[model samples]
Target chain A: MPRFSSNHLETLLTAVDTGSFEAAARALSITPSAVSQRIRAMEALAGQVLLQRAAPIRPTTAGETVLRLARQVRLLDEEASRALDGSGAAVPSLPIAANADSLATWFLDALVEVRREADVVFDLHREDQARTAALLRDGTVLAAVTAERRPVQGCVAVPLGIDRYRAVASPAFVDRHLPGATSGRDVLARLDAVPLVDFDRDDDLQQGFLRRVVGHAPRSPRHFVPSSADFARAVELGLGWGLLPESQALEPLAAGRLVELAPGRVADVVLWWQHWNLRSTLLDAVTAAVRRVAAEHLRPSPV
Target chain B: MPRFSSNHLETLLTAVDTGSFEAAARALSITPSAVSQRIRAMEALAGQVLLQRAAPIRPTTAGETVLRLARQVRLLDEEASRALDGSGAAVPSLPIAANADSLATWFLDALVEVRREADVVFDLHREDQARTAALLRDGTVLAAVTAERRPVQGCVAVPLGIDRYRAVASPAFVDRHLPGATSGRDVLARLDAVPLVDFDRDDDLQQGFLRRVVGHAPRSPRHFVPSSADFARAVELGLGWGLLPESQALEPLAAGRLVELAPGRVADVVLWWQHWNLRSTLLDAVTAAVRRVAAEHLRPSPV
Candidate 1:
């Protein structure tokens, strides 16, 4: 096996990251010809084609293996640099993917607490919890807050806790649309009449809630608000009823701005923190901060 | 040819929109059985299966054809209701998709201006300009601000204007990394040492600019800040050089906080206002408002 040069690996990583040989060259501050040469040399040594050379270039299956290796090496180098320097100012930028709801609520607090202790810069990618793990697979992010239970390859999954949501609506909405609802059947019947708020086209929480409680999905006209903060506000504004995180609903419920429609029934979403198994101080600090904040804010996971 | 019942079409549309027969029933304020009957009747009449019976239901190829018809009828109904009502207070919700950069910049001004005169509630979907048109095609949004010059079917495309961006960096960063840059070549050569800021992994504006001017892509350490407002702030904080909208970069440039890397070269992205071609007064009003705002804020489209 030919020994891989870190410089060639660096060039290959940049080319993949930037999506083109030219873009990678610009990012590496090298000539485009130099970037191509380095990549070619690596491909020759590996005895396989690495990149597809498409617009915003893509890695072939062989390239993905090489890319993963490159990322591991880069992480170790950064770890070594931090160990040698012991300076807070030169903290590495830690890129992590998280769902919008977490970002809108408790995630920022965790980030703030982490920042207070460490000099790391955060690069956050907001995505759905169900999909965030893909960022890890693609090497776009080093860590993620995801709903996936299984760990991505080369990563460890830790249960952060459950974010419980409740079916909530404005007081006036319940009164106007759901009058004389004395029984579960009546409430289920009245659900058809009330407009529902959805997080977006892909949001299924409300439907899932309806399915579990009423034994059927209620098809109500929906107002889709894509933003996490705005979606809660829409429900509060009486645009529609929706599943609001308990952390978000509690204040409005207490303030009389919102009321729970189905009081005991909650939509519990279990979240996990998935990070590279590599031992890096920044990753460790972030994981610790997330766990600490989640313990205080999120409900304990169901046994 | 058999005539389609607007009622049956409505049921079909709701089923697809809500992703289930039960959810559609709730929106229409009818029983789930009634929804099923209407859908079955439509399918029998058309001799085709309209929906794939799955969780969070998906429309079949034939169902998509029917779904489009249902949307057209709904839009016409809304237009008719507004025409007959002539009441500003009961204006319908207008959901539109736009790129994040525009949302962080001048898009809000247009929204505010439109809101001042109309009682319409805005449901904004933040997406990339390259992808916003997908929302229109799938009937998730009625309108979009997109980079695509072509009009979506049943939609009219209007030239909004050009949003020009400039390559910029913090003064301190330039001083530290790019000292004694007499020519574009020197700046290009120094780019490898300087960090770069990216909006996301998909953002290629910086790389595109470098390829055009410097003739190669540089592979430098990058900090990806996905939010437009935050991305600009990252550049201002001396994190990295990036392409910033002229509207955002001008103030910083004047204040000596940021400096232009390439003095004359600029990336001009032409934006379009695409909306459904319907006889809706509200859509017309919004189109007029967006065009008015674009005229004032953006450069006239290239002749």
Candidate 2:
């Protein structure tokens, strides 16, 4: 077998992948003739035709093999470059793998900090806290605020804080529906006939709270408001009484846009930060920043 | 925060990553002015600085954040393109994580069959069998061949086959060194004292085999031949006797170039295919092609 230079293979693969020799040449910033020459040389070396010359040109079987390797070589190069570039005077990117609420509330500020720091890069993978560990497990993300306490394999887990939840209803709806302030089972039984706002099909917290409060499963009609913020909005708009994150509900509650339906009861979910175990300086920098931010914003856990 | 068009970000990232506006423009196959305009537009929208215009331009912290996302966006696009392209008429590029032995042997041929049958592209990750699962878990690869019997979380595992290994020496070395056929403990114990070829410092197979054959571990002074093929070549050149894969040894043995120093007793390593549990057609097609090729080339496991 004739030994072909990696650069030669790269030129040919890029040409075929991008479709036209002219386009590939443009992409590679080489002359079209150079791209052509590289392809011809590779073909002669392998003794096989590589690419089909047509619109949106395609790779032949042999070409695909080399093309695959070419892409890998490129990715490895990119990764190595990222590592090398970050090795000196590089600040860690404030990458936060958070759900909708945190992103909408505090994550943007984190992004701002990332921009202000030394050359840093952010990699955000949006996922629910219950599911963010999967991102950590896959190495798709560097840090995650997750519900799971146990660390995913090859990761470190640190307790961040808790997000408390409370049942709230629109003031108008509560006054009109309840007619009188009653914390008794008789008043609670009437809620079974009232419409309730559920976060989504997967949400059980609202129903679960109702069940525990009333000593039975919820028999109430439910409206599905999927987004965490939207679910709160739906409740404020009098769509239904529902559980809302305390951080989210505080402003509305204080403004009387929402009335606390269950003042004494609260659902507190403990959240943890899970991240890869790589001794990357960037990872440590981001971790420290995130820990500081989380401490300032979230409720402290009881010792 | 200003929303960035994925295309514009991709262009900017490629430009800085490749270095020089002209080089980046060449990489993206657009005019240098277009590259310059894109970066200017991004900086204006973000109302902040982006790239540092040094000899080879570099991303500022904000620029790096966008660049990281640009890389992710490109990868996602490639993956989506592969999925939408499908198999049968065209095989999409199949992303696989496999060990060095498989890549050097039959894996490439199987990929060729996949390309012939479908509109496929491939992203192959070369890793150790023990570490291949980490690639799959990280979502960096679609599939992998792993030595671990237990499947990585969220992945399904199927038997690929077994690779059998045996200790062998070149006829010239055996003649010069041994002079007479010997299977005694003295000969085996002196194996380490003799110069031997090893795949790497981590490779213990040769020494492990020697320890099993003799009462003590072999104490051979060793030379490291990193590549799987090169390790076999080193032994063939009489650099030292080492464990060789049966498939790799077949041609040399048939040509009378190699003789099995210790035959009958060989090591068998079972291999398994593991892939993510996703409702993806591209993954299914690659799995089928892989299974077919494995059946054809690998030794069948005993029931």
Candidate 3:
């Protein structure tokens, strides 16, 4: 086996990050030619083309393997540095991805706990819960809050809890749109004529709930309000009826500001926390904080 | 031909928006049974299932056609009301979608001009430029700023001009990452070793620029910062080099805070304004304001 040079791997990582040989040189405080020489040496040692010479440069398949290795090495180095230093001022930045609703709700509470205990800077990527695990796969984020139950390769999946949603609208809107109690069939028939609220174009929670209740998707005209807080507010203002997390809807429901459309029906979305399996203090710290918050705020997973 | 009852259509629209039969009845100031009777009558008249009997209710295919007709009728009614009112204080809320970069740049200026001239409440939806047109197709937005050149059905597309970007980094970052002069090939080769800044995982501007310069993609470690202003700031802070809009880069470039990586290389993204072709004074006023601002701020479209 060819002996891999840590210095060469570091150079490769820098080149990809800076996007050009000259930029990499600048980042490492070395001559651009030296940066080039190191990469060429590594390529010769690996006996394969690692990088595709494209603008902004991307790694070939071989390059991806090396990039992952380099990142792992860097993480280990950082852990060692912290351990040796003991002051922990040289804290590493933790990049994580989360869905918008989670970010708007209990995710911030977890972040607060993490920040209070650790001297770290957080870089957050807001994405759909279903797509967040892709960030972890691409190595964009170290951890993610996602709806996918399966763990990504080299990662561990922990069941956080379920996000329960209720269909709700303002009392005035209910009175104005649906005046009297009718059969379930009548309720379903009137759904087509009603206006509904959506989180965004990709959001199908309302439709999914509709399908579960009536065995078909609701084809009502919808007002798409992407923000969680504003979506609940839109329902309150009688703009449209929408599905709100039980946590968000509970208070409004209690105050009679909003009422559940179907008294017994609820949409429960199970959430999972996925993170690298590597044993790192920072990662462990973040995991503990997130799990603790989830226990407090989210509903327990059904058996 | 069956005579469509506008009153029944209005009832349907109210029911869909209100999310419950009772809510629609309340909105119409009638009993819930009355709301149900009107809908049943309309369904009998149409001789088709107009609504799916689902929770929150959805329109069937036939119902979608009627829903569109109802919205058009509503728009026309609003226009007529404005013509008769003359004061134009009863302005309709106009929801539009735009990418984050445009929102952070000259888009707000156009919005300000629109607000100054018209009595309009803007419900702005921030999304990626590439995906804004989907909102228009789903009837979520009346107007959008997008990279798609094709006009949505029932919508007209107007060229808004090009947004040009430059590859830039802090002078200090350049000094630190690249100490000495080197050939372009050498510069390309070293790119793999440097750190790069990304707006998000989907952001490929830097990689696109790299591909254009080096003929391959860079596989460097990257820091994903999703905000536009913060993205530019990260580059200035020596976190990494990235592509910034010429509008954003110019001031920093002039102030010696940022330097272009490839002297003559630039990325130009063409933008277009798309909106419903309906004849409304308010929509016309907004279109005019946006065009005028784009003419002043953005580069002319390439012939």
Candidate 4:
């Protein structure tokens, strides 16, 4: 007999998917005791603690390896069911991680196209671009739009494009805070003293951009707007200056709502499509849509 | 000597605020060893570990108690500096937690108004409506906009008003999925069969609405659009039917882009303003602005 059962792997997936043993049992149409038993059986067979039984259950490092195996099994199982029935009855849930800016601007457009003909659901895990690939490694997501160039152990990285961000502020904000500062040199000198907007405390883009302009990330009054749209809106509303993606900034810049602080200096973040190494039809469709739509919106990220 | 020193408390806040001992040293113009020694000294004085020595350091439960004390001391010290200098050079950074929707709609308006007068910066922590108060409990944020009506251990809750949500979908979506299903009964009967949008798996608004309309949360293909504005936009693009806050739904509904699925059935989420019960002038100003602006946009939550 094999050490792992397909049923137990699925139970582990369901438990993590629904976030609790009870919810997983309800989802799988099994008793909570059965869910616990399957998990325990898998742990006993593996000889390691595979899960952290907390408020919302989390898979341990050892469990992550099992989870990757389980996801591949589930994908194959769903593909087989579709092949057998051709009814589009079993919907595949694709878990993908993405940065907030991409999600707001162009990522959903790909999913929209996928949902047009495909019978599928999506679980989008929002993380910073730098950390999105960790989700892929942890088996939390099958794919990710990340800044990571190298692939995870069981994943392949495909270059999406460069997402360029420029330092911009509302017309009124420039008038008030950065008065008489127009050119790159003028702006860089005054940039540290003026207020700015950040996505959150950990959002180092603004600070990073400032440091590139000046020597150090000097003290500045910052407003933390956590939402992508609202972060742009806060800058548009003259709250402070911020670095916005070209996708979000172009139209507003054309409309005379925003002005560039420095003309030539722009931060370019190269994003990549990292997905599990799989031969499933669902993964192919998602990757195709993501690549096609991303090409339309993003600049060339040539090596 | 008092058990705690203001310098030690500030060090703790700086360490947590900068998210690293190395970064805190850079910010405070101190050596990394000195930073470690300060944290160790605080831990020895308090008889417990104050900060987790890891990436993006977090405070333990005992550390939270010290964090709150540190924050209070910092607030008082800043207030004193401003009072003495009368120059507004010592700008205070107020950390506040809020739901995504409120941040997207009326919450930022209050911040904009506050910025027009005060010279303070803001750090906004985004959490779900159910979990925001946890930030206050853990001393991560000084204030919060929460659905939690009961005050945390050392906080006060004031009614912020109600955010009303209604089931809505783009007209094209309804035309495609719920064809000729005009009445509430018609839509509710087939709602479970149609694809839906959720903020995330943790978002139970749509499921709760479905359970009220039907018997159970019947399986439906779901799209997780996590951003506050993007979630509304996804529904507008006809990806899936979703519950939209009236503030977001009103214009689209008026413009005939979106149609109400269940006209009279609405989800009313009451919001409350919770802040640390402190005598500082900054908290008073923030609470006043939050109350004043929230009054303009939200419905009466009289109780």
Per-model lDDT: 0.77, 0.66, 0.74, 0.88
Predicted model with the maximum lDDT: 4
lDDT (Cα, tens digit) per residue for candidate 3, span A96-210: 8877667657776676576556545456787886667666775657789988889988889999999998878888767766778464456555764566777765577887877
lDDT of 3 by residue, B1-303 (tens): 255677787788777756678878876889999988888887888798877768777777766656656655665666677678864324455668877667667776676576555544455697786667766765556788887788988889999999998878787767756667355455555665566778765577787777667676565656666766556666776667788988789999999999877767788999899998777777788899888998888999773
Off by over 4 Å in 3: A1-62, A86-90, A179-189, B1-95, B99-125, B128-303
Which candidate, 1 or 2, has the higher DockQ? 1
Which runs of model 4 end up more than 4 angstroms from their true locations? A1-3, A86-88, B1-3, B86-88
lDDT tens per residue, model 2, B1-303: 578898797777567646789977765778999999989999998887888989777777777556645544555565576566542122223446776566556666666555444443454555676567655654446678766668887789999888788777888767755666576444565565555666543456676776777657454545444455545665776656778777788889889888877667787778788987765555677788888887877799652
Which model, 1 or 4, shows the larger TM-score? 4
The native-contact fractions of the candidates, in order shown, are 0.28, 0.00, 0.11, 0.65
Error of 4 at B270 (Å): 0.5
Error of 1 at B135 (Å): 5.3
Query: Using DockQ as the measure, which candidate wins?
Result: 4
Model 3, C-alpha of B128: deviation from truth (Å): 6.7
Q: In candidate 1, how many Å is residue B195 off?
A: 10
Model 4 lDDT vs. the true structure?
Answer: 0.88
The runs of at least 3 residues in candidate 1 whose Cα sits more than 4 Å from the true structure, single-residue gaps closed, are A1-3, A47-49, A82-91, A179-188, B1-74, B77-95, B101-124, B133-141, B145-273, B281-303
Q: Each prediction's interface RMSD? A: 5.4, 24.3, 8.3, 1.4
All candidates: DockQ = 0.20, 0.01, 0.08, 0.67
Q: In candidate 2, what are the lDDT values of residues A1-303, reduced to their tens digit?
A: 466787886687567545689978976778999898989888888899878887777777677556645544443454456678754322222234776455444444444343334344343444666667655553335567777789886678888787788878888668755678677454565775566777544456777788877887666655554444445655776656887777778999999899887677878877777876655555666677767777777789652
Model number with the top TM-score: 4
